[model samples]
Target: MSQYKINVTKLNLWYKDFQALKDINLSIKSNLITAIIGPSGCGKSTLLRTFNRMNDLIEGVRIKGEVLIDGENILDSKIDLLSLRKKVGMVFQRPNPFALSIFENIAFSLRIQGIKDKKKIETFVEKSLKSVFLWDELKDKLKSSALSLSLEQKQRLCIARTLVTMPEVILMDEPCSSLDPLATLKIEELLQYLKKDYTIVIVTHNMQQASRVSDETGFMLLGELIEFGPTKEIFTNPKDKRTEDYISGRFG
Candidate 1:
């Protein structure tokens, strides 16, 4: 099998007449955290959304490029969106847990797939929570409303909900943006644990978080990928002047 999990070749995107992403190319490795970092409105999140074709939800969006997952082009017109989404689950900037019991939140995906077996759903719920280190704390409160949990707990629960579907890749778009420092640290720790089992791509404006949690880092500027390399190299010794400037607080 190829070491790389996702590949983007000559990718470009436009919202109506305004281009959002310039010719972009990168390869993301399997079972590792890849961070996309840039200032506001630099298309960091836009490129992240392309992996699952989430941009399709917007009106007047045009894309021309190849985004391949497991050697198959997901940008193909005939691709299965439902299956793609199932494989590439997403966690948003804020914890948007459903207004349901904690148990039901995790089981929601399984229920949607027509999985009515109680035993099976129960097993997945336990396993998913365990993966995110929430099983111990939440097992007793399974019937409680998810909204009642603390912010960090809620974010962890959201991640657990994604895990119940057995996705290969997890896309986090500024997942810790709304989190407090302690909570963000906890989430970053969870990312380290998760990298062993799933490929993770994160978009963040937090430079320290990117350096701390990601194995690979890609820097963007004005809708273009300016630099991409091992996190250590990208931070310590970037090849591109633009990347160095951004990393040095010269300019975003």
Candidate 2:
């Protein structure tokens, strides 16, 4: 049987003098998509970063409780940080590609893991690009600089780069916020296809996107998780007043 991809218990986060997350508990099923939605500064992004320990790098940051991946606590001291990051890939809100050729950008992570086989690297690069439906558009420009691609293409390249390392869980922070409507639709379609093979956690302000892309939707407000369940239930018949108010566009 497949195990839970990520489990959080009584999780809380603080940035020195300010608290961002308050006792947030969530479980992400294996090979499924979970969307975190809330207004700005509501701690949706903070909770997403906790899955991969991205909060650890912030100065004066303190966390309480446990975050487990595959039955192991990633916050434990004995865990190797590098390996953990490899297994939990992250794609930021922007398409921050490297200043190199398209092929080089995709090959960067594999090379870091000490994979030096030329032919094998090439094949994997191609395969990863194809996973994001970008191989056909980029195959001819393998050696061209990544900066030459369109914004949507660059975002897809970032997805390809993350896939090259074969991460079990992918954390996306407003990944489609910068794209046009058509490009956003394509990414939403891609997310549906990718969830069959990898656990996905996405933070989005777009209510419609969350409803369309996530199997489970979590509504957070004022640093607290107000409601979480099947997307249909949360949207149609939320138990919490806060959830209803936010979803109904009464107020954020």
Candidate 3:
């Protein structure tokens, strides 16, 4: 197997005529957390969506170059988009669990996959919650509505839902943006455990959060990837002048 899980080469994107990404080239390591950081409109989320071709949902969007996941080019127009999305599930900035019971929220996607075995679905639900450390707290309240849970629990449950399909990669787009400091910390710790089993790519505006949980960090600005390297190197000794300036608190 290759060392990199997602390989993006010469990738470019535009919304109508407004270019959102400019020749982005990045190699995300398998089973590790990679964080994309930048100011708003710098293409952090745009770059994240490219990994799974999520940007294709928008009308008048033009894409260039390659996004290879496990040696297969996902950008190929003929590829199975549904299967690609399943393999690369995403967690949005805000927790958007369904208005259904906790159990049903996790089982909803499985139902779409035609899994009607109740007992088997229940087993996978518990396992998915356990993977995100929510099983112990939520097991007794499996029948409760997902909307009744705390913000942190909802976010964790969203993550659990993503795991239910057994995806190879999880794309998190500013997942902690709506959480409090304590809740953000919990999600950060969860990412550490999750990295053991899944490759993660996150777009975070919080520099501290990126420094805390990421193995590698990429700095993007004005639709260009300014610098990408080991987190420590990017934080302590950035080679690019713009990267150093951004990290030094001079400017975003």
Candidate 4:
């Protein structure tokens, strides 16, 4: 199998008449964390959504070019969106847990997929929570409402919810923006652990978080990918002046 998990070639996006992404091209490696960093309105989140065709939810959105996941073109009109999303799960900027019990939230995906076996669902839920390091903390409180958990736990639960689907790729959009510093650190650690099994693509405004967690980094500006390389090189020896300026606090 190829080491690269996702390949984007000449990708472009537009919302009605307003173009949101310019020709974006990059290869995301499997079992690694790739971070997309840019200022606000630079199309970070917009580009992230394209992976699972989340942009389709918005009207008048047009896209051109190819996004290949495991050698399959996901942009094809005939592509099964449900299957695509199942393979590429997403964690949003905020922790949006279901208004259900902690155990129910984790089992929801399996239930919807026609998994009616109670024992099977229970096993999957336990495994999912354990993967996110939440099994011990919430094991005794499985019946409690998910909303009753703290913000950090909610975020971890959101991640655990994604894991139940057994996705190959996980996309995060500013997942730590609403979290405190300690909570953010915990999520970063979780990302590190997750990348051992799943490919991770994160859109983050926090440069430090990006530097700390991501193996590869892409710096976007005005919808264009200005520079992409190893995280260390991108931060310390950027090839593009714009990237250097942005990194040095000259301008976002």
Please tell me which predicted candidate would have the highest lDDT against the true structure: 1
Prediction RMSDs, each to the true structure = 0.8, 1.1, 0.8, 0.8
> If both were scored by lDDT, which would come out higher, candidate 1 or candidate 4?
1
lDDT of each: 0.96, 0.91, 0.94, 0.95
TM-score of each: 0.99, 0.98, 0.98, 0.99
Please give the lDDT score for candidate 1.
Answer: 0.96
TM-score of 2: 0.98
**Candidate 2 backbone collisions, by pair:** none
- Cα lDDT tens digits for candidate 2, 148-217: 9988899999998999888989999999999999999998899988988889999999999999999999
lDDT of candidate 3? 0.94
**In candidate 2, which residue ranges exceed 4 Å CA deviation?**
1-3
User: Residue 159 CA error for candidate 1 (Å)?
Assistant: 0.6
Per model, state how many residue pairs clash: 0, 0, 0, 0
Worst 10 residues of 4 by lDDT: 243-252
Clashing pairs in 1: none
